[model samples]
Target: MALEINMNNFKEEVLEAKETVLADFWAPWCGPCRMQGPVLEKFAEANPDVKVVKINVDDNQELAMQFKIMSIPSMIVFKNGEAVNCAVGLQSKAALEELVK
Candidate 1:
């Protein structure tokens, strides 16, 4: 399961993590976000080494603004505390795997 994150732990959980982190920026009301949730879970299950997290844009507006999240279901892959890849809109399990790779 993907951990739900907030500003309080954003740095510790994502930016400072040793493993590759997949941060899913989404809101509960977004249809696409809902669709993406299970895919993320599946991805997390398949790739145990990768860190998966969910950031609610409604709750973490500052984080969203910092990441320049203009759309729902935005997926950002972080490596070595830097954003290495980003994808907007809903993504498949295969696509998520590709992004992390």
Candidate 2:
């Protein structure tokens, strides 16, 4: 399972991390976000080198706004403390891998 992140730990878990980070911005009420969860878990299991985390928009409104997350199931790939790529929608395990690569 992907680690659940909030504003409190966002910097330590993602920004300061040495490895690539994949941050999934989502809300529990969103159907597509719910669907994306399992896929993200599978991706995390398959890709041990990458760090996978989930940010609940409802719980972390500040983070959601900071990232400009207008859509649920939005994915942002961070490397060296900077956002490198972004995707919005339900994503397959293969597609998730592609985002990190």
Candidate 3:
């Protein structure tokens, strides 16, 4: 399962995580976001070392604003508490692995 992150706890949960963190910024009503869901799940399963998180734009408005998430399916990967990679679209598991790697 994906850990939920929001502006209220983003700093503590994502920026302060000890390991790599992958944040999927999405919305429930978005078609593309729904399509990307399974891919994210697979990525999370394959990368247990990385903390995979989900930030719903509807539930976490502040986080979406903070991240400037204009897209429905955006992903930000953080390592050592800093964003190292970002993807803004539906992505394959292989593509995410390459970025995270």
Clashing pairs in 3: none
Model 2, range 1-101, lDDT digits (tens) per residue? 78899989999999999999999999889999999988998899999999999999999999999999998899999999999999999999999999999
Q: Over the full model, what C-alpha lDDT does candidate 3 score relative to the true structure? A: 0.89
Indicate the worst ten consecutive residues by lDDT in candidate 3: 1-10
Ranked by lDDT from best down, the candidates are 1, 2, 3
- Please, what are the lDDT tens digits per residue for candidate 1 over residues 3-91? 99999999999999999999999999999999999999999999999999999999999999999999999999999999999999999
Per residue, candidate 3 scores C-alpha lDDT tens digits across 1-101 of 89887777888889999988889999999999999888888898999998889999999888888888999799898988888999999999998888787
Q: After superposition, how far is residue 33 of candidate 2 from its true place, in Å?
A: 0.6
The clash count of every prediction, one per candidate, is: 0, 0, 0
Please report, in order, the local distance difference test score of every candidate based on alpha carbons: 0.97, 0.95, 0.89
**Order of quality (TM-score):** 1, 2, 3
Give the TM-scores of the predictions, in the order they appear: 0.99, 0.98, 0.92
Error of 3 at 87 (Å): 0.6
Cα-based RMSD of the predictions, in order?
0.4, 0.6, 1.1
Higher-lDDT candidate of 1 and 2: 1
